[model samples]
Target chain A: MEQSYLIDLKQVVKRFPMGKGSFTALKGLDLQFEAGEFAGLIGPSGSGKTTLLNIIGTLDLPSEGGGTVLGHPIEHLKASEAALLRKERIGFIFQSYNLLQVHTVFENVEFPLLLLGMPSEERRKKVMEALDWVGLADRHRSRPSQLSGGECQRVAIARAMVKQPSLVLADEPTANLDAANSHHVLKTMQQLNEAFQTTFLFATHDEKVISYLKRKIYLMDGQLVKDERV
Target chain B: MKLAWLLAWRNLMGAGLRTFLNVLVLSFAFVMILWMEGVMVGWDQQSKEDMRAWSIGAGQYWHPAYDAYDVLSLTDAHAVIPKETVRSGLVPVLATQASLFPQGRMMPVRLNGIPSQQSLLKLPTAALDTTMDAIPALMGTSMASKVHLNRGDRVLVQWRDRNGTFDAMEIELVDVFQTTVPAVDAGQVWIDLSVLQELMMLPNEATWLTMGEATVDSERMAPFVWKPFSELTRDIDAMIETKSSGQAVFYVVLLLLAMLAIFDTQVLSIFRRQKEIGTYVALGYTRREVVWLFTVEGSMHAVLAALLAAVYGIPLLWWQSVVGFTIPMDTEGFGMAIAPTLYPVYSLGLVVTTFVLVLITTGLVSYWPSRRIAKMNPTDALRGKIQ
Candidate 1:
């Protein structure tokens, strides 16, 4: 069966003002990702890969042209509506595993559900289920600092998936991990993707990350160089 | 909303030293404001009471017939003091200066001739016995000690009459009074009206009739021929106005300083948390949510500071009341009794005012920075970019 497009971008552009000049970050790019697709965005440093991911994540607006996420026009969405879309339909995974340092693993995972005003019992059930899926059930009570690099990323994954968002946008997920931890994190993400069939969009320059995706989009100097399906 | 609060609280806890410093500075400012307000309120209350005691009632009296420059009446006491004075509910007293010869040393004394009945009622309880009969004339302890007059000593008094003729009489010093109010204890001599009338050659009259309480129609006293004390001490009105204005200026300066401190603390807090605030926005929290989060945090700090201030303020106020603050004795001279100790009185209105002032300052200080947080681009915020 053919899949439906979860995110679609056409002629998207982003620019930043710099010292009386403008730096064009993304220039007239077109992209599309289907629902339940495990896609990778691969590029060199400063090649606008992260900028594209941010635009897709509804964290930034295109300077010109438009895009759609979950069938909603990104350009026309107000800030509040964009935030609501992000809250209800999307999850984010940062390169640094941006877990609130003061909260334990369980609490971190419980955050989004709490924002949704879930009851304590419902929140606990969802958070533990996410942690169980990420294989961090035993470490739920530990703080981020107390965890290893791999454990912290697992906690981040649990936090991302606890709300069961339709799409997960991860920025350099294994950038800070060692070889063994990176392998473990990639394996866990793959397991989650196969089990839940949630769409995963990863932005990275690392070959190890690029090799893990079923589909890959390549960019060079703010322009798309290749789009590949595996 | 709960998530934001949880995140804010977590961030606050994570940044322990920063949060502690902010709380300390905030609480200190709160305490200082409350303490200053307490002192001002206490001083105002003390001033009002002192005014009442020094001037007798809220009103005063003098002979309407005599001009400010004219010699005061000593013999024509009836012109000011009427027979139906008590019926009018006015407490009448005769005030004049007399030459005192005590143990052969001469000194000037202020003789306050109060009616025998009214004097007993108005005098502080410490000065008189339970009986309605007259106690021997009350002399200030300082004056009594200076002249070496014991309780039974006789002092010769001389005074001028309304016609500028002089007369002399003798009175026994029976009671000595002392008060924390310094000026009153230095030169006052309280005497009976009958003795003062005979001594000044106005045998059946009183010189100045002072009312203990305000008359129902003080305007009636205007036509009956007596000037109120309010007219005699017109300078006090100016003094009170000057003091009030000075206090206002001081409060304004203090408030400005407090606002600056609050503003500085909030700006610094936002600057330090730029990354965190950005992260929150990037994590699906709207700008309004972010602004509201910071606002709630600021309000929490303000409320905590106010609570701490109240805890510290009440005891400090009580201490001030009990011990009192002293001013230089030699600065103001004898006839004007300045209180040696001043106490601050606490009022609910003052407390509420201080709390509101602090809350408003905290809220305003948080506004601009929270707006900045709201306006920030999530991409920049995520990259820890601050402008």
Candidate 2:
């Protein structure tokens, strides 16, 4: 039978070594996400939300237990296989707007497509479309250092969305943005989610971001406490 | 690899001043190395040519008793000239030790006797054919300067005859000539072969015969041992090789300075760009790929430097080769043949070898610092946290 969910995790436990002992970040966590879902993992600091997000992104693997993401067992994937999974199927956005500071907005958005070995003409078209989606088409020539914080984040969004990956993993994507820029970034994400049916998973505690998620899963002290659908 | 090159080039260009400084230092090294090596080659070639023209003709045949290194052998070095060898255009040279009293100052000098009409050597021997009241002789400018003797000046000369009898006579300095070869000029005097043979009572005897022709059969030269050109000029070749070795140290120091500048920049770039490295990982590059990217970036500096060197170095080096570099101080006293002005000769091999060596070295130093990136955690790197 075909899998119904794009991500399926069971009893995923994550432990990090600290001093002579270990600190457990996630305890017996089970989660699932279907295609095209717009969801958030809501929590306070040290509640293991980002750690869970990293696992789902395949940036990390669970210390114990295993999960399947997009049909591949995440725990057993080699480093190269994980990189290919991210390259073709996943996109990441960070809060501080981790754009290559030296590259222009157009070049930054064009990076993922270049990695895909897309022809130059096709890459230019896709990069332009992605920049237009974030309302930064006119600022494509400006470097990240030359742009405002919101503009920098939008360029990052353009970079992540350039390849139109099936899943987008965002960690505190609005933590550095003001109220107005946060709403603008969220609306951009909301529209992209509904338009392409791409799954959006965010790890955040921001109220503005929480209100925008269709489903919110709350965690406390490394354990899930509540799940709600608005 | 192409993507790495494109990104590396852009990154270096974005660096602006820092990149310019590195390329400038490396290009300076490139030009200097080629210039110095070219000079060494020029010196080697000049020395050989000067030696050939000024003293060692095609080759020589030494009397069996002759040993240039052993002064005592000169007494018995002379032998009867072979008729066949003399007929084959070989110029007989008779050498004997003599004492000269010039301006009341006594000095010992090597007296060389050559056929006045011979054209096998570049010496002004024809001047020795004069019928002056005193026996005519020639002195190198160096020897004349040291003895303070001028043209037409008579100096008292003393020598031993074939019968071991000491004889003295006044010889007029017919001419004072200039030559670059110190071996033939320093502490030496030249006179007509017939005059010296009659004076020494050793007619038809010669210490050595210089060949005017390009090739001669050593077997026919019998009692006189033939010395080929290679054997005759071995000392000059050795001295030049030693000089070339000494020059290698200077080139090494220059290359090291450029390498250090490049290495320092690469280390700083890697240290400061951890976040950028992590971003590359998130954008689908493996840690190995990122390492390769940085390595290529560093190697590109060498490529840029080579191009930059060609821009300015070509015209400058070509001008030097054409105009030549003149030594400010006197070198005739250095006891070797050295022209006043040295024209550098750059071979295609020299330029290519230097460029390839510097490129590989730059790649190594760049790769050395880049290896640290392979061990970094993507999560930590993405957060700009040093690990």
Candidate 3:
């Protein structure tokens, strides 16, 4: 019943079916996040960083755990309830920059607002604001296919930020970009984080992404190894 | 649903040629189903019109003993012509079996006798009122051609009377008229009703009376049963029904082919665009919403096809209705009533029905493949993995 943290987990475990046996993606772990925190779940491959991030994002549920995200019990949320939680309170940014290829940058960024049934004029204004935050306001008419890797990531960030959700879950958001593009994307996220005071949770092992985080939680073989604050 | 439609429309338009090709094939089905159905309806209408004009005017009253399919029944099918029926302007017809020797070749024919000056029917009965020495007889062009006789030719006609007495006479082919109704033409001859009555020794008698302007609804007159218009045109109606069933098969196949293309596209879209589907879910769409999105996307092909079909079909179908379709071969051999050129008739019901059918069928076809999305994992789909 402790609903103080934005996301709270205790004794959480996640398992996947693998040919007559089970693969434990995450071991018994205790974690918590507060409002407006900039943090990262840092680990190498097969170390359960993405699994924990997914659990917090409400995209997946822990097999045996008591978890709450934004005052909603993660394990008890129905499909629509989970979807609504994601829709109104959480945003996601993937490493691949999964922008709709057929849509212009403006349309892509405006999608979440459209889902919320926002009025078109107001939706357009908010979309322009999000694009300005990412410094891609002038490229609103260009499609994802027409944008560079860094620009597409920026558009994804704007899309995640357009609705101004309480939390944003980003998984390896800069993995596909070069060093310059990676630093550029990171700077935009850092600025957006400070300007909006929105909580940012990332699942990554990249040192560049790790360097920008104010708090880092390290995982090793599905167990929490360390929690550090800069 | 509106948002889904808008997104589907944009997606289809963005797809460009793939969407166009599917629409093109589906549009072909739309036009063909409508066009062919229209022609069938027109054929039915034309046949009924021709029959009504040339033969059975409004309806007919047949003698109790008459069986059109039984040739021997002609011997006893005659009854005295009803005075009240005559007063109602109905045309009485008397038919008897006869043998005609044209150029010494014998052939059996039905000698149908109608009033020479009757205006109730479109047959050239007035041509029977001739001043020639021999009896004036009129036959259809097919019969005339079959007998190899022209106008002014004389042929020997022999027949039997009520008393079983044989008699012979020479009749002149006064008129060889052209008519589309096979019932009124083909192996039949028309002459003065009075002359046939006198020859058969059964005066004031007729086999049947074709109702004219004033339709009679009398069952009181025994030995004469009233046949309504629908009853009289039963064979033609049955033939049209059979043709309609055949047409249903044709268009169903046409629809299936178009649906196959849509089904293939939907299957391919679900597999090839896994990332998009996952993105949709990650963007806060329910799996069911994603399924509906794909279904709407597929169904939109029919909408686009209908519009595209309308772009070309309206003018083409209109032109066809006006100019009519001409059969490439002779229709005379077709036993029932048919025209050399057929004009199609389109109704609002037909067009709307075809449109709805294509829409529903395409939706079902699209939905069948889209159900797979509900089972897909968002994490896996985001990774573009086929699950």
Candidate 4:
């Protein structure tokens, strides 16, 4: 069978109001993401890489055209429904490593499962397993602040993957990390993708992240200029 | 809501010092509000009791013209004792305006006549039962202290009889008693009923009959107007209520200050933790759920405060109620039945009311700033951007 698309963006357009006139961030871009595909949207500044990521993550709505994720129409989706979509299906990893600083590593990882209303014993097992993948199983009790930058990023990864979501959207996951830590995080994500067949998408200009992508889509000036296999 | 509460509790605890300070201030507010209100309520209760025990005995039957509040009403307030006066529970007492001299200073006084053996009042009149060489008299400690008089002291007493003629005599002060009822203690003197009857030439006539523990039908004969205990003490009750209402303002102010701290902290937390808020949304919480979490977190401070206040307030209040609150100032100066020290009474209702009030107040304040989240854009919030 032909590869199925988990994400299908068609003629998507996004504009933001600036001063008097509006600024177009994404113009009529079409993109498809298949299950278990490791893909990246690569571009320089102002190329709408993050915007497209946000739109696909269901954090933003298209000004004109829209898309679908897991067969749910992105346009006209109520805020609550969109939130439910993000909650049940989409996982996000930010460049800033947006881990809840106050929570311990385990608590951070267990957050999603808690939201899913999972039982305590099950949550514990899943959290520990996710931590194990990030190689932070022994550091589950440590707060985000107490961990190193690389460790914090790994905790963020654990938190994202803890619920075993269908899709993970990473925005420059390695933007703040060194070469060794970046490779470690990418390799872990790679293992999770292969092992669970979870769809992985990245919005990044980082060469290290770009190198790991099975497919690279290049954008400039708010339009896709190229799309190709790595 | 369970999920919200759990997450809220975790967040508040993780906040550490910020949470502790808010809880501390709010707790102190709880203790202060409850303690102050309990004491005032206790005072109101005590005053009513003191009035009942010292003066209004369960109720009274006043001569139609008799008004204890009006000095002029006393001039002709006396009437023949109502037939109800013969009842076992009725204690008929005569009162007439008189002038007394102590240390050569003349002062007006209510010279009341009571049966020395009567058990109806707590007047300590047994002192008058003594057969002294001079006239046996009883004056409250406040009157005695004010006039520089003491027990066994001979002083001049003068009064008008039914003939409207002035009479004078030197009578010995037999006893000076202390009483909590201001009306009973201030500038009042007590003497034998028979002697007063003879002196006033109005046999079996009285201004009022103080009802004892038993009830009497004063309406049977209708010589005097029957005033129930509550009606007799109406003014005092109103005064206490008015005072309590005024005191409520201070309590609100205290709570507001405490909640102000909480409100300020909530606003600051939302402002500083925009990214965390976004992360929560990204994790799956609805905006409304986040608002509720902050509300519970803020209100939980009150719960913590109440527990903390209980740790100290219970002991302090208990000790006070037992020992009684002493007035630091002279009791004679208060002009009313104010006990020197007031024992605070904390009823279960009062405690529960204060708890609920604080929780509601804190919850509302927490929700106020958390509303900013409802208007927040998660995409921008994810990057720690305002708006």
TM per prediction = 0.82, 0.92, 0.96, 0.96
Q: After best superposition, candidate 3 residue B179: deviation in angstroms?
A: 2.0
RMSD of each: 4.9, 2.6, 1.7, 2.0
Model 3 chain B lDDT-worst window of ten:
B215-224
**Candidate 4: which stretches are off by over 4 Å?**
A1-4, B131-134
Give candidate 4's total backbone clashes. Answer: 6
What does the lDDT read for residue B82 in candidate 2?
A: 83
Q: Where is model 1 more than 4 Å wrong at Cα?
A: A1-4, B1-7, B46-84, B87-90, B97-110, B119-137, B141-158, B168-173, B180-188, B201-265, B310-343, B368-371
Candidate 3 is scored at a TM of: 0.96
* Model 2: TM-score for chain B: 0.94
How close to the true structure is residue A227 of candidate 4, measured as C-alpha lDDT? 96
DockQ of each: 0.52, 0.64, 0.70, 0.76
Place model 1 in a CAPRI quality band: medium
**Across the candidates, what are chain A's individual TM-scores?**
0.97, 0.98, 0.98, 0.97
Candidate 2, residues B1-387, lDDT tens digits: the string is: 899998999899989899899999999999998988888778878888877787878788999999987767889999888876756888899999989998887898888889999887899888887786888998888889999889989999999988889999999999999888887789888999998999888899899998866566677776899888899889878987898789889878887898898889988988889888878888788889999999999999999999999999999999999998898989878888888888899999989998998899899989999999999888778888884
| Alpha carbon lDDT at B144, candidate 4 | 86
Least well predicted 10-residue stretch by lDDT in candidate 2 chain B: B212-221
Best by lDDT: 3
Report lDDT (CA) for all predictions. Answer: 0.72, 0.89, 0.91, 0.86
How many Å off is the CA of A37 in candidate 3? 1.4
Clashing pairs in 1: B42-B345, B60-B228, B60-B229, B61-B229, B91-B210, B91-B211, B92-B209, B92-B210, B183-B337
Model number with the top DockQ: 4
